[model samples]
Target: MTGKSRAPNLMVFGVLLCLGLLFLVLPAYHAGNLARIMVLAVYAMGYNLLFGYTGLLSLGHAMFFAAGMYGLGLSMTGWGLSPVPAFAVGVGAATLASAIIGFLALRTRGVAFMIVTLMFAQAGYLVILYFGAYTRGDEGFVIQQADRMIAGIDLSGDAARYFTAFILFAVCFLGLAWLVRAPFGRTLIAIRENEERAQMLGYDTTMYKLRAMIVSGAISGAAGAGYALLFGYVGATFATVQYSIFPLLWVLLGGAGTLIGPLVGVFFMFYLIDISSAVTSAYMLIAGLALVLLTLFAPQGFAGELRKRVFAWLP
Candidate 1:
């Protein structure tokens, strides 16, 4: 590949290599934290695809995440399906939910779209509660270690879980980086920049947006499914409004519309909380102040600012 074409591949490989090395060098506790961060980063990347790239802000992504989590959780707990099939069912559930939500929500734009999505998510949460007997509701249910295996590998183990998360994050990270450089990805960007103009140019903006939403939701769901399988827990908290807001925070803090931004943001936020909580009971206050400072000085986020000033080829 030419230098320009090779840049993204090299960058992705470097990141994966760094993560692999860290797994070997870091202490067990931190290694586990990094694994969780990687999974959460996958979720943030999904959010970035729609918000950062397509300019479609959502407030109900937790529903898609929950859809995948519960899909896997219930399929295994209720139906006795194996982890592998249950994982597919979980992702498929999120995909279907996104397709349905996108079909309806894309009909509106701006704040209206956000409201519609939030409403749908709220409904999903309520439905999960209504079927508390099956779901175990807000208290949630746990998957035993036996059910957390795939192809004879136990995901419940620390190393297996960590590497599984690593693989999931790497695949999604590389896939999205490549996608954003493709023609379809560029078309979404064009629509994000000027939907009317894209429509004038004879492109189907709605269709493109719908497709973006489905892709975004699918990735988010995968993260959720992975979390349930690896972590061995499925709970209502993952479906709450706070969960929906998390990816937005991660994307904005790292840098919107940039490939590495999600991972950077996830890592920063995770450590910020980790270190702060150790120092004082009012960790959130410190986090809030830090975020305010970042907003004032680095509005485009850490990676966004870095891309702007230093590595123009970042992505």
Candidate 2:
């Protein structure tokens, strides 16, 4: 094909893809669930920065995720703040919490670090659970219809909310892409490969690890904000230990080392869960078994394997 003809074809394809996505989202679009998936994807991306890129295993990321959600929920419900400001507050709280946690967690390495993070997260969960009156604890927080005005546009409609979330996801995704390609990212990879060697080269490994933690936590908080806005509710279940593991699974399932892998993993898992639930009541068992099979047979995950097969056939 000529270059000029190819350009037009690509443009048409892009437009078609966008239209298709819009159509799919429009009909089955539950504001709450869409928000949940988007935010969960964001949350998983943050974990990917640590586990996928940095090779850091954290078992307590849900602490920050919950913190962000509850922080937004409390601000909007208790203080009558707007979604934007409330979300910012939630991000701040999660960031600060992560900073403190990172400081302590960074002191250890490897499995010890994972254990420390898990313990901290569990402690956070208990704290939220015990304060039932303040947090509504197990009952969760109900979101009320609050005015969401952005540049003269009232974002009360489901479509508006979905678009808002898509915008946020795009921004975060782009930002992460840039971050992973930066010099700092190279240093993180080095640390992941050999911390002792990175330290010998004067790369303050601890500082890099802590920085990653903060970035991951902040992004997770941003995701939580999206969740709160989408669902108009927040609760303890959001921060459970299981939520933390899912992101790890997503990264691994999608080919962790690559940038687009987590997204591929999310889409695959979402559809898999949707289809499996429709087929049987024992969806969880099936999902678990699928994960086991994926892990056992496709260690590099589906994306990595697909890429290899496609490239092999091309040449």
- List where candidate 2 sits over 4 angstroms from the true fold: 1-26, 30-35, 147-156, 307-315
TM-score of each: 0.97, 0.87
Candidate 2: 10-residue stretch with minimal lDDT: 7-16
RMSD of 2: 4.4
Output the TM-score of candidate 1: 0.97
**What is the per-residue lDDT of model 1 for residues 50-75, given as tens digits with 9 covering 90 to 100?**
99999999999999999999999999
Number of backbone clashes in candidate 2: 0
Candidate 1: residue 260 lDDT (0-100): 90
True-vs-predicted CA distance for residue 8, candidate 1, Å: 2.3
